[model samples]
Target chain A: MSIYIDPAVASSLRGFEMPEKLGFGKVMAPVMFRAVCQDGCWSRGELLPYAPLALDPAAKVLHYAQSCFEGMKAYRVQGGGVGLFRPERNAARMVHSAERLCMPPVPESLFMDGVRTVSAYCANLVPANSGESLYLRPFLMGTQPDLSVSTSSTCEFYVIASPSEAYHPGNMRLWVERENARAALGGTGDSKVGGNYAASLLSVARLKERGYDQSLWLNPGNRRTVDELSGMNFFAVLDGELHTPALNGSILEGVTRDSLIELARDLGYRVREREIDIDELLGQVESGRCEEAFACGTAAIISPISVFGDGEREYRPAKAPGPVAERLRAALLDIQEGRAEDRFGWMQAVEAVGE
Target chain B: MSIYIDPAVASSLRGFEMPEKLGFGKVMAPVMFRAVCQDGCWSRGELLPYAPLALDPAAKVLHYAQSCFEGMKAYRVQGGGVGLFRPERNAARMVHSAERLCMPPVPESLFMDGVRTVSAYCANLVPANSGESLYLRPFLMGTQPDLSVSTSSTCEFYVIASPSEAYHPGNMRLWVERENARAALGGTGDSKVGGNYAASLLSVARLKERGYDQSLWLNPGNRRTVDELSGMNFFAVLDGELHTPALNGSILEGVTRDSLIELARDLGYRVREREIDIDELLGQVESGRCEEAFACGTAAIISPISVFGDGEREYRPAKAPGPVAERLRAALLDIQEGRAEDRFGWMQAVEAVGE
Candidate 1:
């Protein structure tokens, strides 16, 4: 893909020093991938030095939240090379998100070119330690300078990488968010858009104040069924079987969630994808029927839920990290880190650009 | 307020030319007002030449839509000077919007300073026509360059002005949106956040394709009561009495909507703020009991609704611009443009900056 390599990229990369502390999404790489779309035409991708973006004050994204993004990781595999776990799914979901916001979709080829270019060049920055890797964020935004609440004619797509550790390190306490919803049914919930994330911050903040790590949001339509956490999918182990909320219209189709389902089924664990009522799940947790509960996403791979704070009441599962959750997380990581064979063929190896 | 007025502002204003065509929010003024907040402390406000904002790529606003805005106007009063109609109300509403998105609220005094400073400097650009004014858009966004799903520590606030004609110049045909929702039940619908506007765009685009001007959204909580149009509040003249949807948690309390309610009462018209079911309203429109319906906002003061396009049927009000809507529009405009006495003391006049 004839991507443009900015002249200063080499210097920026060479001059960059990896920090001693690599927190999640904190230490950004020195270079980034960018492409622009104007009037339905997509420009060739370019790798340029990372810098502030000069945006018009009246850009649609600043006023209307016409933006979408994906979180992914480029892992430094078992032996040598780097691999992207199901990058194609992220591209497809991003297309759906762009269409939902009426922004021009970045074609799969262009999306791949941007992701691969950034991953190949920044391969050295990928963390080698277990539970750490180079996190890639591909974001698209409406850049047209207008105050009208309409679709933007111009768009900018960017892919920025950050070498960081895993997001959540310990068991999490979740507050049952009955008052606020992350997204509405028949809304942008299924899409990885900025509005859904924007709507979730208040709930997370409130939960944090109440001594919880995250919010366990219920479905907006029914207001009783499980939806997801702020940035992850919800899962529980009941009666020695894995249960997760089905892909409702208001639930984001998480790539890690999908991978886990496949990997779990392959590992001989019975997985059920159906509507799981919140009250019923909480009851199971209290009755000791639910062995463990967890949340999964690209950032936090698998964070076990230790306590469910529902208003004044708190419920805990039999185990914080049950045997099933531990097994599934290990199996998934082995495939992701190339310690085991990529039986599912989910990893896309990216060739590194030699120094 | 001691605002920092940049030296380059004079040159920008002096060299600016007004475009012949003044579409709504199209012709931007040459200068803007800006202020920054870092770690809970706000910087002094500044008035400088309007220029592109250099934001970090990882700024929370771009990736998570942590932004809110208010639309207001500085009118060219009947005699000579410019006046802002209930500018304090806008400031108060913006505070609520910012708080909902977990951003630091722009202090009321600072908000007034930004709006007044921009309006005074751009006084010459306020259009003189009845429905035209200097449309001022005051926006606040989280500017911290972090990828974590948390509230931003840094924020930027700005007020930009556009001299333009009224939005929605003619009668509007609205499509009854039954599928997609603009906001959730306990979402950012009541606040003037970017996410609510972003979520409404898809429904608007779909309706525009079906020959409708806007989407007549339903209350997300019940999905039956009339909530609003995309960016405006809904009102109807039923049985010669004005009725509007109450300020449900999912409805934005518009400034125009509130002003009209007060003005209508002064004009000896009964105004009701309660739930108006969509099906019942459609039936009333079909039966000629609903004389006219309209949408109101800062840009579009009062736009009469001609038809409501349900799935396979179209319901029309007896008159597109019935006497009630007509009289209310004229009354509101009269006070706004200074043709009538500011009986409610809503107009806040600003002294122009000498050239």
Candidate 2:
């Protein structure tokens, strides 16, 4: 569904100026797209200047945490055109996330409209360089101000863009987080809901104290199998093959992780999706059977992990950025940066709307 | 801190009238309280008329779920007075919940002032029934309008109230929630936060479809131990003594649970706080060792559990509102209703500011 843009949007986009230092997601674009859903019927979305929201203090999203969001990027594909990578995946995952929280699912068509509209209008704000792009955050929240725990009957969906530089996930050491599970069994771990992230902050805080950059969360069902990181998916090189956790109920289906799996297969690498038992994996890392491990997400693409620590014991690899991680990162960046073929049909080229 | 009464508050409260039917937390009170915090320092709270909150579209609370809240009541005690039962506990729990999300804590004094001021001004709205009261909801949110996941530097706190009737918790048949966890292990289960409630909504919805009232969550760490109900603490009268899951990291420290333990001990009943394994609990029920069980919180003073359904198996207790639950519910209600003495100093009497 095409959106009817307001006349003021052009002026807002034109008058907007980008900050010199574009942090990860701190700097937002000038224009946004918004839609409302009341009693299961959705209204037509409108593109307007970015503005603060008006909500009752007792809104279910504020008090009950009935909110979910999607993270995707508008890339400056080759030939100076803008496009989005795996936009449909974010839309589908967002639907699942909303269902997990008992909120009405923002339709995939509406989700795409919001993302594509903002991305096309703010194409000038899409950053250059390898990792930098205009990060699009599409979020839906329950707006009915009430004190009950039932499903919210009213909802609002908005797409806000942040002009971001390549998120440089610095040298990372991971802590084998055993005590805290990010999502519980049959919980919203597989869905991208706000509650899952809120539940993870405590573990991330503790891992930061232990001098680790991220916590390698274990599966909540068994507390023995490997789950994804707080915001990314994990990949380890074992026995000359690439291995990642299967899509369990508690692991988010990351877009970046999925792209890498397909790319790895195309590049003639054997990939496996199975449970990585924490104890067994740690032992393999200690014994040199597991050579290198890394994490992948849309924000940073791929970040290599150098060390894995569990309590006092530590496991370090001979190389921080191993050959496999480096090769995969460069391959993915090549496609994203327009330096390679568009054969995989991964990127959807968006027409640039004049500022 | 002394607060200046806003002129608009008087008009809003005067114009507001109780609705014909007051469901739980549905009809909101007209007035509210607000305070701002920056860099660990808090501003004096002001009681103003309740209105829609103005928030940035990219606020961290909406996106990252950096928000926490408390549930409590302000009872219109017998003899023409109003009082709050152990509200300080909620204030402290809100602080802990905020800390878990890395957000600034609402100052204890500021929190107290907000609740008391709202309750004092809206004392007339409190229902005069045995189990009914002015349900007070105190929530703290990260209001900084940025989307990145690090805790917000600026925050806002608000206390809103809802006029309601007695929460008649019928004899509930709980579904043994072996698959879904309300909160994660090492997660925010123990904290009074929005995320935990949102995560539990799915489980509640699924169990309702299966003809169950609420979910009996298991300890996420082991998945075999009994934690508590979604928002209440669990207690069972086994072998003529009160038994509850000990204050494990996963179980919230319910104020009513604490008060009941104290009141029960003083009334010559032995109480034990230990790990209540689910298997052992079911066995005890079958063998006639456990006679009755109940769940307690501010909303429902004491809700008796009638049956436990674990997937294919169903265990019906010999008694629903057994002698223990009946006695405890009456004992607690007497103090709340001002019929009995507040011997433990649990009630804080609030003098109504009548014109």
Query: Highest TM-score: which candidate?
Result: 1
How far out, in Å, is residue B182 in model 2? 0.6
Model number with the top lDDT: 1
DockQ of each: 0.89, 0.76
* Alpha-carbon RMSD, candidate 2: 2.0
Candidate 1 ranges with C-alpha deviation above 4 Å? none
lDDT of all the models against the reference? 0.92, 0.88
TM-score of chain A of 1: 0.99
Each candidate's iRMS in angstroms? 0.7, 1.2
TM-score of 1: 0.99
Q: Chain B TM-score in candidate 1, rounded to 2 decimals?
A: 0.99
lDDT of 1 at A311: 86
Q: For each of the candidates, what fraction of the native contacts does it recover?
A: 0.85, 0.85
